[model samples]
Structures are given as structure tokens and as C-alpha cells.
Target: MKPVITVREYARLTTDKITEPTLDLAQVSVSAFDWLCKLNATFSNAGAALVQLENRCLLKLDNYVGVLETPCGTRLEILPKHFEREDCIKQSRVLLRRMIQVSLDLPTREVGAADLQNFDAPLSEWVMGRFLLALDHLIKRGLRFDYQRVEEEQRFLRGQLDGVKQMRQPPGRQHHFQIRHDIYLPDRPENRLLKFALDEVCKATKDAGNWRLAHELRRVLLEVPRSRNVQQDFNQWSSERLMAHYVPVKPWCELIIKQKIPLAVAGEWHGMSLLFPMEKLFERYVAASLDKDLLQDARLKTQAHTEYLCQHKGKNFFQLRPDLMVLHQNKSWVLDTKWKRLNSSGEDKSYGLKQSDFYQLFAYGHKYLAGEGELVLVYPRRSAFDAPLQVFEFAPELKLWVLPFDMERGVLLGAPEGFPLHSQQLQSSEQSA
Candidate 1:
């Protein structure tokens, strides 16, 4: 027997990598908290909030970012002040690796800058995974959350998302799945009649082992049969000859028609799809939303102009890394994705301006020269600041953009405002960044 699979089961396992216990909201997912905390250390406020969300709450956000990228999808990167700090994992290198992979894999074949979408995956799962693994390399890394609390807490959040209760029955000896699907066929009146005629012709042809009969039957049903024999010119038919013609195959027509279908069938397969349309709508929404990130990801692989590299001379270092790198034609700029909060005003600012970020980008500008090229910093969208696209200058032409992201909405709208820069975009970028 096939093992039972439900949308609920898929969600639980994929979300938690576990089957039983489900998930709780109040206790917070330990894995989520740990991941967010570590993300905060490396990325920032975006990291901090991700953990808080894991605890359970009705949250909605929007964000966007613009960056100049390397061919391997490297965003222009700058190191934060607390580099290698105990709480932080060194993700800059791993992040750069993602940029590099995207740069090399681009369909355009450019060098210094490419979109992050290309590089974000392989690196996130592999390089980033290793980095996280190394972060846990310490003997002290222990559980920070309890599964029971999170499961119990999950109740409150269910009301906010659809299909949360499509839960599976407890696992048992009988493996099973809640099969769900839906189908839609053209609904036009003409289409319905055509479909009906086609079905009848096919049914008749099924008994005769002839496919040409089906084709001619289609024409005949539409009402145009010029002659009794297959050799007869269908062209000779008058206007009224077509519409409801259903000529069964003629013996002589078989001589002219050499091909036939061993089996004939008709009508849409509705059983599979009809079983579940609501579930399909939900599934479709998920797929559409997820794909938004893939298409809008601005991780671009762009190569510096020959002149830009030649100026660097000895350091023609075959490799360069930049996240959120922006480019127009051959001109380019760069930025990095940060998950941390941007605290402009506060007695104890959780995250303020990082001198190191300025210094790091300054070098990239000094070498890559953003004033000549350009550089920017991309961050997740948050409520801490309203209308959060702020610009800071390390150099005149080089700028930093604290873009917004809406993780739920995707880039289906022609040129959606954010550069993978919506709330959903913000979340996905920071997750990989």
C-alpha cells in the first residue's frame, strides 16, 4: 500500500523535517529560533524578526532591494563590525560562493554581476548548510525550544493561513494519502458542441481502429463533407455541408488513409482533477508565490568592464563577489542583503550603521569604484521603519538601498515595485543571503 500523504504531512515534514508532534506556536520552533539568531549575527534585523515570527503571530510585511551583482550573482558585499563574533557564523564567504555560482551559471554568460536567483540555491543548501553545520560544530550547541509548546501554540496561527487543518490522521499500519486534484476545460458553447461531436466520432472510430476517421469526423461534425469517398474533395462542399456531418469510414477511404489508432479515446479526464479543486487552488497559490522569488531574484552575474579589471592590474583576481549588485547595460553597482533591523534612532540601537560595512564597500568601490560603477545594500522590509528605501553614500555614485520585500506576493505584476524586493522577496533573499 502507498504511504499516506497529505498537504499537512508534507508541510510538517518540510517545515520541521519531522512527522509527529506537528508544530507549536507559543514555544517557538527551536530550529527556527536558532536559525534566526544566527542569521541576525550574520545578516541583521531580518534575522531577528524571522525568529520572532516562528513563535506565532499574525504578521504581514513588504520589502524591496536593488543591487549590482557579479556574474556569479555576488552582491557587492561589506563585512559587518562583529566579524567572526561568537554569535555570528561567517556567511560572507559562503554568500560570495553563491554569487560566484550564479555568475558562472547565468544564461547570459556575463562575469562580475548576475542575479542572485541563479546562485542562491546550490549555495544555500550546500555551502550555507555547511556554514550552519559549522556554527553547530561547537559541543555546546543545544536545544533552545521544546516541540510540545510550539505545537500547542500553533492553534492561534491556523486561523490566519488556509488549509492548516488539512491535518493527517495519526500514522498507522495502513499507509495512505489524501488525494487532491482538479480539472478545467474550455467552457465556450461552440467548444462544448465540438467536444461532443469529437467524442461521438472517437467512440465510433474506436471500434474501427481508424484515426483519420476521427479527423474527418471532426470536419463532418462541424458539417463539411464534400464526397462519399476519402479521395473525394472536401473542398467541393458548400457552406451548409459543414456543421453536423458524421461520415463513418468508407472501405475505399481506407486505401487512401494508411494510418489508424489502435485505440481511440475522448473527453477530458475529469476524475483526477475533479477530486480536489479547492486544494488545487491552494497548491497553485503556493507555487505561484514561490516562483515569484525565483523570477524576481536580482542576484545578477555581471563582469566588470575590461577597463575596470585592468585598472586593478596585479589583482585581476579571477574571482570577485558582490550581492545586490546593480547594472544597467555594461555599467554596474553592488549591494548586500542584511536581515537585521536598521535602528536609526534608539538609546540601545539593536543595529545601527556599521563602520565595517562602510569600510568594506569603500574597498569594493575603491577597487570596483561604485562612484564610477555603483554599490548598494539590500535588507528585508520591516515595520520598524515606514517607507524604508533609504540611501547612504560611501561615495557619490555608489549608494545603499534599504529596499522592502513582501514574501507572500511575487513579481507577477509587470515590473513589480521591488527587486525581489517585496516582503516575500525580502524573506527569501535574507534566508539565502
Candidate 2:
């Protein structure tokens, strides 16, 4: 059996300790450590700083969380650092899946049934199961077909005759006619890409159920050929309004086909890195939640780049993109999410808030909100920082709110009095508008 170890974000794996694994620490053999070092090296070479190697034998995980499998069948599961409650691993795993689903714009109901049924499976297994579920959905909706042009020799010509090829036939093959024709078939680029993804997932999945499902789907797509060149197929893939159901499955297929680590180094380690940066995951999750929870009249925009921090001689430089921008009537609010946990202890009077963060938010307030509206720094709601802190005033008209977002409730907490939220203020604004 594979050695499955679970840890939280910012956890460490050490080769010096051979003791039992804990939530934040684990012991791996030298060989496993070498595999990790290779993995880190590959990530660095690909311009991604996902993990850091300490000393020589310690492998430290940064903010990237998910599953990392080694070539030797050692699996490292990293969960969110703040999920410290009972059964936190399971909770974090489910939450991570939801975040990925939201980020990919997949409906929660479509790919979550199998996930909920297999709660204790590894992250990789869950991912494979999700892909299989998506394939199943696509199969039920009916596989799409496209016209494939073919040139062949037959007893009778069906399409335009290939006179040049027919004239070159041997003496005994005078009856055979060379024809070029287009046939409506299921061997298009999209189905080929899906078939390739299914093949990759079949090899990577560890669950028997996933294997069986993949096999069934492969049988269903028997007419579709596996992609000979994935990149070429991707270039040829096109979206059609009629095949709208393909939207949710395409991302999963691409995710399965491409290694997340970003480098294709030649080595014995061919395992997949199904990791996601916590910052991006948190930002996208918060944006999606806010969009769903906000009133219809109020619109939320993500990563809006309508402003710049400064202007140069001939061009505008330092473009500012706030994570979440809420527009209600004539009012605009700029909210940026931080995946870092806040320190609520008295020893840290600043609540561990970075000075640079305030500067960033101040810049955003001046540019995005016209320097007079409310600016928010949203952090995950943990036990230490379950409520909003006191508001900071940059000026008489400019105020910055450091608020906590309740992950469980999917709501931002402790907005100041008279804030434009679900209260009468928002209602009145909508009414007035």
C-alpha cells in the first residue's frame, strides 16, 4: 500500500524524524525526500515558487494545497492551515473541491455527487472521480459528431473521384475507385481530447470505481480516437452553442491532461501535482460567493483593471486590479481578499496585518473608489479573527475595513453600521435606483 500522509498548509516533511505523522509534521524516507527535492527543482525551473526546501532533508509546503504524489507511490495531502476543528481534513478536502469547482465555473450540483459519496478518498482520486462524473454527464447528453474528410480506395466512388490516384492503380485493381469524401463521425478534435484525458486519468487514478467508470466511458467513446497530439487537438478544439454542456467538462479534461507543476522534466517521477495556490483559490471562491449572495441590482466584478496607480511620461504604469469590486447604485466598494490568517493576540497589536497591505489598499481606495469610498481587506474567518476589526481612517471621507469572511457560512462578517450590505441601506439604494 502507498504511504499516505496528511498535513496542513505551511507544514514540513522531515527525513530526520521517523515518528508518526501529525497534522503539521511528517517523516519521509530519504528516497521520498529526494523525489520531493526533484519536484521542487522542477517547479522552480518552471518559474513557480510553490514549495521551499529547507537545509537538505526538510521539505516545506508553502500556500499551495492539494495532493502531491511521488513516483514511488508516496502521497502528500495538504489541507488548509486553518481547518483546525474536528475532522478538519475531511472538511478542508470538501471545501477545496468546492473552490476548484467554483474557479472552473462548474455547477456545484453537477460534479459533487460522487465526491460526497467518496468522502475519505485521496485528492487525486477525487479529481479522477470528478472527471469521470463529467464524462458520464457528457455521455448522457450525447457525444457530438463532426464531418471528417477521408480519402480511400473503394469498389464504388461515393464522393468526388480521385482521378490521379485511380489512374495509378495496379492492373488488377481497375474496378477499385479512389474517392475523397467527408463522413459525419464522432472523431472530432474535442472528442479526441476528451478521450486522451480519459486515458491519462485511467492511468493516474487509484480508485477501482474510477477505473470502472473510466472504462465504461471509454467504451461509450469507442469511435473517438485518442488524441495523437494533445496540443494540436487543443488548437483544433472549438466551442459550439449547441454543445453547451461541454463547458464544464473541458476544464476538467485539460486539468487532467496537463501536469499542474508546469514542467515536463525527464525523470522517474511522473506523478501528478494536483495543487492549487491558496491565494487564487481563496480569491476566486470569495468572488463567486459574493456574486451569488449579492442582490441582483448590485454587480460584483473580479480583477477589474480600470485604474492605474501612476502615470508615466507617455504611458500609464502600475495597473491596479482589485480582487472584488462591488457597485451598488452610485456607490463603489473595493474589497481585496488575503489568504493569510490574521493574528488576534494582544502581542501583535496590528493583528499581524502587513503595512504593505495597508499601502496597497490605500492605493486601491484612491484610484478604484475615488479616494472617498469604503475599502475592505478580507481575510478568512478563523477563531482568532472571527469578527471585523476597528475601521482605519485614511481621511475624513476615506475608511478602510478589515473584515473576516466566514468560510462555513459563505458570508462576510461584521460590516460597520450603515454599511451597504443586506441591510436597509442596500434595500433603500435599490429602491431609490
Which tens-of-lDDT digit does each residue in 1-433 have in candidate 2? 6788888888888988655667778887788788778777777877776568888878788888888887777888888886766357777877777777766565555555565646777777877777788889988998888888999988986999998998999899999999999999998888999998898887777788998899988888888899998888887777778878887787778778763322233456557557777888888888887777676688898899989988899789999998988888888888999998897756688898999999999999899877898998999998888878888999989999999988765677776544446633564566689
lDDT of each: 0.32, 0.80
Which candidate gets the maximum TM-score versus the true structure? 2
Clashes of each: 92, 0
Model 2: residues with Cα > 4 Å off, grouped in runs? 45-47, 85-87, 111-118, 157-160, 167-173, 259-269, 345-347, 416-433
> Candidate 1 at residue 304, lDDT?
35
Query: Can you give the TM-score per candidate against the true fold?
Result: 0.27, 0.88
| RMSD in angstroms between candidate 1 and the native structure over all alpha carbons | 28.7
For model 1, residues 1-433, the per-residue Cα lDDT tens digits are 1111211101111223343432121122344334324432433332322122323322111121111112222221111111223222233233333322332221222222344334332221222222222222211232111122112222233322223423543556123333333223222232333234334334322122233444543453343222333223333322332322211111112211211211111122111000111122222332334333443433344333333323365665433444334443445555554444564345445345577766666666766653554555534334443344445665565665544332222222222234443554555567699
